[model samples]
Target: MSASRTERLLNLLIALLNTKYGLRRSELRQKVYHDTTSSEVAFGRMFERDKGELRAYGFDVETVTDKGWGSDDPATTRYRIGKESNRLPDVSLTPAECTVLILAAQLWEQAALGSAARNAVRKLQAAGGLVDPELPPGVQPRIRPAGQAFEDLVDAIHSQHPVTFSYLAGSTGQEEERTVEPWGLGSRFGQWYLVGHDRARSDKRFFRLSRFTSAVVVLEHQTFAPPSSFNVREQLAALPELPVRYAVVDVAAGALLGLRKHARAGGDADDTGAATPVPDCVDRLRVPYRDAETLAEELASYGPKAVVVAPPALHAAVRRRLAAAAAFAAAPFPPIDFPRSGPAKRTRKRTSEDQLKRMLQLVPFLVHNQGLHISEVAQRFGITRKELEDDLRILICSGLPEGYPDDLLDIRWDDDHVYIIQDLDLNRPVRFTVDEACALLTGLEALNGLPGLAEGGALESVTLKLMAAAGEEGLKAAAVAGPDVAPEDSAVLETAREAIRGGAQLRLSYLAPQRDAVSDRDVDPHRLYSLDSTWYLEAYCHSAQGLRNFRLDRIQSLQPNGRPVSSAVDPAGGFPVKLFTPNDDDAVVVLELTRQGAGLADDYYAERTAALPGGNHLAEVRFGSADWLPMFVAQHGGSVRILQPANLADATREWLDAALARYEDSTARQLD
Candidate 1:
């Protein structure tokens, strides 16, 4: 960095300390830039340079000492900026982009702490010296992980090795030996589990981490060794996240699906001549953005086109997730009398009626274009290059969960001047297609139907997209936006969330399906969560007197009427599947199969059976999941089942029984 830039970096630190954390000079350097080692050889005068740069950037830092206490300690010096920090970034952003960054920081704050998150608080805190850093008091503890074990598992997933731990069965109270070569870890509802090959058991398995006594890295530095012929996600995505489809997606000609798709390699059926041509129907079709939200959005896209043809087991799983998600979203929430409208007045006085030109001038870049320069951004913004280095510091701090989560303001200033990352047509209007409006309405409607307590969350995300599609008028349009709301139900959920966080006891009306009656009770709501699109309050139900599932849809009303308790709340657990599939005689129900499903059966699930009976038409298969028998059958489509007992057949029949009933019920309703 140049001498001037270096000096500005120091001043930036001083301004940061004075405004945000209230740091004193000598102590501030020790916290961030100072070397902790006692050795002096590697030291530099970072502190002195920082002080000199602060003055040059037009920041006046005053040093003060309180004279009293012990006479010896009277000689202390602390820094407080004259009138906030002068270090702002030179780059510019439209008010909307700046708004998104702020919302992202707020919405993503907690996720950033997750090991899976690429951005984090410590990172933002280090660079956002000139921008505002405080989150509104109401928005603490952003989005809570459904469970902590899932969080820890996600943290460990980016590694290659066998996870060692003691796992106990919830009912049997028996612990077993397990050494799993983890492939991937995923979360559902409120728990986390790992999918990998287990050398100890000689099979592929899914084990929940929350049920373990201890979780540790027993070994490290293992080869990723994805089976030369498999697709992992397609195999594991059997339930909640997406529909496991069988229609042959056109794999590139001559390209083999990665073998790692199987847990480990089920059999020699991982094959060739039987390979079919990649169909032209889906030949590199357009896919939506590959961001996290895309995964959730899939539920809407794959609704009826992707059918679970044969295995009754897979069918139930899909229905349950959707029904559960729908049931959850359509449920009731705690009541609140949210005001009928938004803020009645702007926080600031209306400066002028000059329209677009005036709003553009308010943009940081346009207001200060003279001093903006690529190299001198540090000097003009009064921030260190590193602070304003990556993204615009002004935009970095602009989100509000305190308001709607997605309200966006594109504020950018770059190169020590106001420069936007992308141009937004503030001068033009936005028009939406009928389909886009339908999609937008559908998403908003989903929010409107959410568990009463969390209904607002869904709407907030919808409003954000709407504003983005609304074009030029933006905030001016937000002022006129309206949809009548019955605030009573939503009020309850908010109060419940508040009580849960504040440690307050709640009085509520709960309906239990098993009993089919609503009862009044007092309980402690430990956490609030949404899974499969429905909202739920996880708590120690004093009525059940144990950790129980209370659907938000069934909740009638609620309020914080009791004191917060001091006890800790245990995290949610996963649904267990007791079945297995192995690659050899050692497993149950062996079958010769097509080369298609071999990688999944052999490699990951360890259910690979022996070689094809004739090495010409089929491959072998084995797997274990007592509940999955029918679902497994459905997934294989028309594939042959070599070992079928009266029980497995009866199981498939049973699922059809339930499904046919549901189908019949729909028909009856339509006829009415």
Candidate 2:
């Protein structure tokens, strides 16, 4: 047997990383372990072991084909250590920067995003610059998406392997065995979905993670090639588009601006190029929409500020839903508590091949939650007791350079309780993967958006400190040039954050999107959150007399009302307003891009884009609203042609004509 697989693995890594392109199998054997190549069979076995070991340590050995750039043949494939993935830039984080990173990590605790965040923090700690035994207090906000199927689905998606899982079909409401070639995984509207090619039905399908009734079983023997043009976002855009229809509605003054802000919901100005004045403080206007349900919900949120007039169907639907809600509230019903049934499934044990980060995470958790029962700890970590025990054994055997008894981790445990009795320095901080670093960086960016922090100067300063720690190579991999936050928006965010912290009420001139009007309302700012690249203030509004979510961008003006707030709501209590959910049934509209827009092929929805000759491109952009398609086309500045859904082309022309009239009117006024 070889003396140490670790020594050989390190030698192999050095050889691979040093190479420019990659080494062939023969070249790898000759360079790394000359004795193994004495026989072809022995070399093959050694190479396989080394490759598997590398992958286990988080290195993906990418393969390149000999048949030129576009060839799909695996037989001609040669392997190389992916340069970007193979290296981890040395980071030296300042204490303040480490604190910021810690806060960022805490933000996603117990979240689907937590896995990446925790691992990144673990790596940062492993780098040995700033150290904290536990996360700081008062920074625990989690957005946890519950599911066990997500991991299995992700695994299948990565391996490009077909998986069989019993899914609770939405249409039938029964569990059915589905064999799908997993293509991509995405999250929208706070739910995870697996978009894949269903082999059983010979069609692409979206499987919600919550719908899985059984564990996803990856079929090891079956593998499939994903289409080159497959894009998860494009596939999700299949929902039905709303048909174009104009509805006459009456709204309060200044509400039109609010409505226009969400022009995607069909904001149309009247012939006067302004809102139509109506009776009783309401201004009449024509709004276009495809989705009656969503439009109704938006209008209802405005309370009595807006009224749906024409389009009897939409008016009736809104009235009916509102009436039913009132009736339900007026009626009394007994609360029934349903008992949970079925025994819990046994947890799967982890093998040595699993990433060691999980073990690192377990250490801190166990240390903090000391005296917890063994079973309790296992449940907390989402692992079986046997698996936890195995991790414990592994930790006990791991230590510093000498590999002696005192240098190793002193883990004390019994069947009932587990505890760590020695110094916490035994566990070397794990290096952050690129994705992990990006997640943490994005989180820091989110925190940086908030104002009213006294301890830290600006979030930007903290980010700079982190970037310095991450080194040059790390920045190249993780840095993103995101859209700049508007100065006014940032000011509003700061003021609102202060109001929330001080428990003070604010008099804010806010645009209610549903009402299509601006109104001054006294609000007790509760908390601030960002979604879809926009900051939102969740506050208790005194005007509508309810809790509402307000976009910071729509806030015209904000002033301190001077009155102390009566109550503060939990930051995570409000409903997550989904901006959009692409339905799998939406009509796909293909657009032929001119040379001007051809370069944007990569920027467009991935699954819907295809390259053509002469630097032209065709994209099947998703549109569920009659209003969205025309606007999308107009925004392209005449560089695109709507090829499918002939009706869309006509709609685009109508929108263009309307725009031209507005511009003509503006020019005439200027001349006068």
Candidate 3:
């Protein structure tokens, strides 16, 4: 049965138990499936199935048959799951089994595992086992799943129903409609995939959840019986493996640390397994990859730091993307338009899964750490105090069904500390699920590849222990494919990290690309963050006498400044300075835009658009520097015109003339 239907059944059971007499079929249907009322025969069948499932799951559903019991009715049947049969007896789980349950719950932190993990946790809790859902600090792994489609598909799978949706196949990059009977779902390499018998294709196929482009609608009255011999893992293993080829690449020193695990395995190795270290700041390494295009994209992102030395296809793919990028820079582009006609939609609230996770973690936390400051708990859970309070309010009424005052969770707070009156016996930390363990192992491997962590470091040891726990199947389930940090860049990152950690300053030889120069500066390193595969350091520059953001790649050298950060400069006081912001040095220019160019109003000047006659628009555009204004206007290809600041317009015209002359001259040269 579907999880929703099972939930309804449980609610019906509770309602039946709450009454002195069993509820008739009509009463049960009205009370339980109120929103989904159906035909009499359909309701009877569903109710009967629900009762049978309850019995199968160890609940005794009692049926009272009445033969005109002092009334004018011919016959009547009423049903109830008695409390003695419905309520779970004492659950005595071993510590190891409890740990497994905890680990299973913790698996939900990853997006792909979240919904199923949450359902599992709730079921366990409902079964009267209070589970501690929190894992040890520093064990979190970043994992993103297939979002809403995953949850919907999980429901379809559980109900043995067919689901219809549009799926975008990666191989073709085209969306096609499909109806499938979902047999199972699995995660591999941090990606969720659904396996099912495709109705259109008449064959079982695997679909990546990420490819789902439309809502998964479960067929109302259609269901299928899964084969008794069906094995999800077996099917996944039987899926065809793509052809793999080895590529020999020249890697820069200290870069490609993540690939060192495959070190000396295939290349530059003698009879002994020791790797031959090629010198001259470049190492010849053999790397195996299945997808050439993917590998090319990854290698190209590294730019000059790494080069593909052999296998012409891989190199060509990288060069192709680079050439396309160059062509785009010299080409005129279409204006981007965003739809803005509809009324603003309400922001979605956190999912019930998120609420359940927080509650599961929050309860045990409060139970173990009684009298903890409410503010501290909120901070610990990475939620606002108001959100924390809202969760508490929700929990106040949550407990066993037919919720009596004694059955509900007892929560008490005195504006400062929070206390839980009842102990749920869920105070142990969650262990790691196989997939989660694999994900964390992958992260730890990347960390261990770094020089700072390679030499018997804590992270390295953790990696070893986790590998031991993961066993063979877990190791094969996921992989870590992170960017290769050049040794120099890694060292710079480490230095900045230490400065941030120790509250010290850093002396950096930084390259300013826009200024076409390199300069020395002392900066109080604040934090390090990665975006678009590039690491940046946010710091207070002593030379600039202001906060500045420095790309780690642009830092030629970095060293400690031998002084602690000043107390006056709070490391966390300021917000991130945007790359483009209104400043005293910037110019506010008015632009007259055609319909095509005006479409960009929301993007460029959402708050400064004014409609003009003849379907034109006037936008107030701010420029940090007018150096690129001419090129930017040229890129718009006459869709825009400068309306104010005559000097700026005249300068832009001259720049355009110069650019035209250069292009004309280049064309003439080519012709000659």
Candidate 4:
């Protein structure tokens, strides 16, 4: 009544034409008009008038009143707009978003970190109407290049077109001739690099397109063999953070390097071979691997030569192995377990109704394969259609990522029923593999044996289901469930789950190993988080006057203490977790070591090594935290030297002093 309903009909018809099917008059009336029942006669008159008007605008509205084509369903009478060859409607993304998406596509086309970048690229393509649904968020590219070369290269690579270009290799003012078979593209070290087979060398090589002169595709045909079974991400991630040798690689030097020259893995050479002085053909060791064992071995080979850069875990592992080798040939034996201590111990979150409630609570999303019918889902789960549909509805709405841009509810609906939009087979459900099932079942069995968990049989059922899904082979892994971790001493964790449920405060004596102290703290427990097989109470901690991660394994004692937290507390803001606590005095303990030390620097729990010297071709590792200092020191076993910071130096010296004191006292006693 307010606007021209006739014009609106034509517009709707135009939009509908893009889909595979079309609606008849009554269906159109039902979809577009709020009260279509009353407009039945008017709707019919408008439909014919609209068809005539649209035909004038060059829309071919073919009528189907003839013989076999006549609709028996009666919904085919409405005129359908022929496909629009002129233009498509504008998409939902802003220009800025579109630009980002295009760039993401550029990155996607050249990505070696395939899975990691897949979603972002997919989402970008989705925004560009290239892909469907969307991908989740991920770590932003640390290397943000402000050039269009990356984009252009992606197009050329994807199109499989040939491009002529010149690239400056080094300071010799020499330009090499190269025609390449583009394999992939990737970003590294704040610049973009392309991986392709060098036509000149008959080998795979990397080219920095930004450095190439007159790089443009002149070839029209796109035909080339893509590299088989090669992952770009793995190759690129293998690059060293910093070079031990010169960043530049001469033919002889590169050939001598032990690290394999992956198409795009490294930016500089290592100095592992640099110390030879006489300079045999090459001047560096090969790439330091990410695998803990391989990295340990590599670091050991370097002994004191290679420098490790990037990622804390790898560095720690190398340092750990080196320290262990220095201290002892074998790992220290585990602490002795006391005889069947107290009564039975229960699982932290092992409950039936609780698990069901959680499942229900988290059900709204996670359904991606949309083609599954409700009946099929019911059959697969051996449940009634009602229950299955309810589960599906929950999955249709359930997920994290606040508000739900990433929510997996792609259900398409007509006036009568709902249909999930899936391109693949809907009958198949996402399931765990044999190994994964085994791991899950093992965890489930461990949970079953835990104290308090015996009261709930849900975990057992889940385990059975997982095993059944994986079949007999999976049961073997589950059967191999081994010894459980002993409960931590000096900390008795009592989860305040009931307290949070019933609105009560908990009194706790938490062990603070940093200060070698255990203090009484009052907490209003809200939640319990299970991470890496340990429970932690996430609640309002009154001891620190804030929230804290109270390790369930580390609770020395627990009792009822205070009332529920209610004083205008922010639900979102709470105590930030420090990875580890410090001991008595803060120590700026600097560790001086070889390139292996540089590699090991990544494994630190605290801040970075200050004054990192490339000059020495070694790493100066520093630590200032007290948390787990003794344990960390013990693990390292003394290949590392404490450079400065008086207190930590004293601590190191004190360890040596105590060892010396033990030896002297033992000798005296023996001599006497």
- Quote the RMSD, in angstroms, for model 2: 17.4
lDDT of 1 by residue, 408-502 (tens): 23445433454543212211111322222222222232233333323324345535654454333222221111111122345665777678668
Q: After TM-score superposition, what is the CA distance of residue 3 in candidate 4 from its true location, in Å?
A: 55
The segments of candidate 1 whose C-alpha lies over 4 angstroms from its true place after superposition are 1-152, 168-174, 201-203, 221-236, 240-554, 557-672
Candidate 4: list runs displaced more than 4 Å. Answer: 1-431, 451-453, 482-495, 529-540, 550-557, 566-624, 635-664
- Which candidate ranks first by TM-score, i.e. highest? 3
Predicted candidate 3 versus true structure: per-residue lDDT over 145-220, tens digit per residue? 3345665665676557899898866566557999998877655333456888898989988886645655677895
Query: Which stretch of 10 consecutive residues in model 2 shows the poorest summed lDDT?
Result: 477-486
TM-score for each predicted model, relative to the true structure: 0.27, 0.43, 0.45, 0.32
Residues 295-348 of candidate 2: C-alpha lDDT, one tens digit per residue: 655554343445565554555444543443333222332222222431122113
* Model 4 score (lDDT): 0.41
Relative to the true structure, candidate 4 has a C-alpha RMSD (angstroms) of 22.7
Of candidate 4, the 10-residue stretch with the lowest lDDT total is 135-144
Flag the better candidate by lDDT, 1 or 2: 2
lDDT of 1 at 368: 31
* Predictions: Cα RMSD each: 25.1, 17.4, 12.8, 22.7
lDDT for model 1, on a 0 to 1 scale?
A: 0.38
lDDT against the true structure, per candidate, is 0.38, 0.55, 0.55, 0.41
> What TM-score does prediction 3 earn?
0.45
How far residue 38's Cα lies from its native spot in candidate 1, in Å, is 19
Scored against the true structure, residue 473 in model 1 reaches a CA lDDT of: 23
